[model samples]
Target: MSSLHDRHRAVIPDWITLYYKDPLELTHGEGRHVWDAEGNRYLDFFGGILTTMTAHALPEVTKAIADQAARMIHSSTLYLNRPMVELAERIAALSGIPDARVFFTTSGTEANDTALLLATTYRRSNQILAMRNSYHGRSFSTVGITGNRAWSPTGLSPLQTLYVHGGVRTRGPYAQYTDERFVDACVADLEDLLGQTRAGVAALIAEPIQGVGGFTSPPDGLYAAFRRVLDRHGILWIADEVQTGWGRTGEHFWGWQAHGQAGPPDILTFAKGIGNGMSIGGVVARAEIMNCLDANSISTFGGSPVTMAAGLANLAYLLEHDLQGNARRVGGLLLERLRAVAAGVDAVREVRGRGLMIGIELTEPGTDRPAPDAASTALEAARSGGLLIGKGGGHNTTALRIAPPLSLTVAEAEEGAAILEQALGSI
Candidate 1:
């Protein structure tokens, strides 16, 4: 341990600067709070970017992981693993998609990659459509479908793939169309794209609630209408719920549910909340997509016994506590308080999101810059004041993203909000 400390004193990697690396070296966590190496306690409102759903060092999750590790850590997913099978069954049951098939991966990006591949391969087409301001993953194929141009530099021209109007519910480079007009325009563009291609399009991937896109949600009737268009064009609908699934959206188990859509997506991807800080993600598909998969579809380390155990434990804890209900209850309280705070501060342009996944958009007076600088400053201030937060959005990365653990107490919520309020005041 001392040798490790000495090595760390020598030099840190350049990649560490890429992210707003917090000064507090996180040593450990319990519940919604983490401790730094210096033994300072800080509230974790960000939840490791919303991955620690059940909170850090949760007893159930820790015990399960330890037990599994003690027993057997790796049993190549090629063989049967009870924990994996059981977790998959539970996920399928929770998703309410009858006869659903599950494929696991190590991260949300991997799950998304699998879903994209499955969609294109099942339909045997190269054309795919993704909404603007969307974020799927950093991989080549997934990045190709991401609409944020800044994510891929001009030199990476090959990454710039076909795109349609990202729906016009909210204003940006795309005109703000009425809900009906937005749906019609998106449908028309998709149909036109499909027609222009010699072979039919493969899939249309979208986030039920755009996570890194400032928590932007689709308009009412938009999802159903989009599904109708996809069905008409014989294209598959892939809901990228990597950030919005697992009951984070207080209204329903999945963000898509809030849209009141009747049918399920052909392929659904999930992560973030699966392992409660452990890396786990997966794609659940219906017969149409799953039937096409062969031996090559398996991920070498995807559903290993240890990860499966972690997922099972985390999910079990979530369900047992009815964490979904807690998210709704606490989220409602948090939202109300945030809205009130926004009203008090003119810098806050708007507050949006469902359940625990929420965003507070900041804007400057008479400036097109949506107060992104202020947002960054506020985040830094909040960290110094003992709270963690995240930022997202395209041109305007001014939205303060908050996704605390499901088990966060009402008082803890108030404390977190108070920290944000103080940070805003300082900014």
Candidate 2:
């Protein structure tokens, strides 16, 4: 018999790099568990980068897609579909935003690109402010705003845009002034940057919980104050909740709501969990801001019946099951456990995030300073122990992301945490 790794390597196609490929081959999934080709089951903690909120092959979502596929598969954007309308209405109602209007897209990147285009078109301003370490998408325009220098070879975008420090104000590449004075300084810097620009800014895009930036959640009152600053400068506030939205954050249907009653953003974008991995994305903007895109905007396969059905079914599943509440309750437990585990590890520095979006900041064992590759190595160890995780940070993967599915149960979470503890111990 061939070795598992050898067999997989021989059969696997080579069109793309098998990043982190192991001997195990995932065959199928149900709920939060995945079975490999060898029939050994493993718990799924990463949840397809936090998109599989309702879990894999959810019967309801599958049935909805099947039912819709049987009725009508595709529809042009020029025509309206009931599934689309229903999903939009349900999203609007659950989001607590009256008269919510939605524009559909194929993915998060497309949605972010659409939002950027619409903002520039409406404001007629090329200058925009994106938070430091923020990740919008990989599209050209979205990439222009992404603050991860590793993602962008050039220091800054050639376009007329600026990246302002966000999150807890700190130093280094992902500096987020955590202190009030630092935040004030950041605000001052923003003021100066905006003043230097010839025209007013179009928008300031930020993720409520910096998912790719290490799940950084800024201190309370920051967003409300930032909104005031934007109001003063007549700039739009765009909340990119692609990772934090759709009931994953708990206590709020959208991550923006968890930002401590900060005034509602002028625009909001979501994607990851919206379709439960069915390739759907959209933007919910205030009617006023949306009107800016009314002139020259069109979506081709945006709200197709297939995607719309998935969106509707996913939304219904989330609401009926109160997945958000589950995330909060379970996330709280997970966070507490992670913090306790970190407390025991001299290399563990901090644990941060909201709801199910958790991050473990690792450091050198003795100095208690950041360990460049320690976190990444720990993630590898965790993978070996059958737990999948994501890594984030600026240059070094110093942060470990634990954004499991909303359907993760207490028992599974306890097992994952135990395995994660073992991984940390090994590191």
Candidate 3:
């Protein structure tokens, strides 16, 4: 291991995992590529878990930060912050919720936590409904709602989170069912869960596409059907779009739009890509629910001017250049290419995802069981071939996740896919 990694392990918590057998310290990045501390160049397929929504070091975002920093950085929530307000206004308009109010946080965990806090308090219940394989965040509140055992460090929880069915499409009990039947089964299961559970369930929070649970997603319109059940009980719906928002999913600006038949969620949470690489997490809710909290609260680092400026410029670039369109066109190509490559590989279990968020699941040659070992081999091989990617799955981190910057070009997609093909071959 490198001396830096040794030093990191000595101080940093072991739970904060690093990638690859020998971790890479990325020193700089531009566009879809990054250079490691040792000066090895690699195609960055994960974009730091899709936080770099646009290309790395985009001049617009960099300059905006510089300009904002020159003026000021922090005024706290107590004072007037122009950039933060501007960003909140922009987000409120973009949020599908009517009469929506936005609250910024420092990370996705904080965003989801705030949503949970609002939900339970507004509804006056500590009960929550979460998908069986969903992952929300790493905080106490979020971990309680997260159903994936691998991610949740403890069984103790502040909220009585009820696990529901229907996030994973290919491995769950309802996997064999058709899309129509799958939706029906999941909806039926949800109804049963509600009937069997205690009264006053605050909300059914879900990720449109489960991020850390792999890039798995329920069938389209699945949530719409669930919404019908939730409505009958007056239960709210919260969409955790942390890793799936801002056109990363290509077809929809928000992942919830894939199930738009139910209308927008009562609360929508987002973070990863909105500020490019800057830390920007937030919750958008209708005025009724947001204003429900009686006590005062504030986030010291939530909407700092510097980060808000980065968010504004990054959002503008995403809109003006139609990065969503780029994600669609180039991501579609990459998906097709990966699928073709996976077809000939015996260890490949499935290839799935939308837009730039793709996952290649590895199994034991012919078996359907998760091959985390193979996943590790594939990761190392990919790195050897000068490609940096990511890993995630409920089944012990068995899926290789490829989510490049939304600004990825067709050429970069092809190149990354080619490298992935080689990596899979080696594994």
TM-score of each: 0.92, 0.90, 0.99
What TM-score does prediction 3 earn? 0.99
Q: lDDT (0-100) at residue 392 of candidate 1?
A: 80
lDDT per residue (tens digit) for residues 97-132 in model 3: 999999999999999999999999999999999998
Best by TM-score: 3
RMSD of each: 2.8, 3.2, 1.1
lDDT of 1 by residue, 41-135 (tens): 88998888889998899998888899999999887777888988999998888775668989889888888888887887798777788887788
Per-structure clash totals for the candidates:
0, 8, 0
Give me the runs in candidate 1 sitting further than 4 Å from their true place. 1-22, 153-160, 166-168, 173-181, 294-297
lDDT of 3 at 121: 92
Model 1 sits at a Cα RMSD from the real structure of 2.8
* Shift in Å, residue 360, candidate 1: 1.3
lDDT of 2 by residue, 1-427 (tens): 8876677668886542343535346788999988778777777887878888888999999999999899989876888688888888776666555467888898888888878877887788888888877788877778888887666645445347687765633444335444576657667777877778888788888888888777876655667668778888888888898998987877677777756556677778889888888988888876767776556556778989999999888888888998989999999999999898888888876788877889887878766366757776787788778787887765443678898889889988899999899989987
**Model 1: lDDT of residue 143:** 78
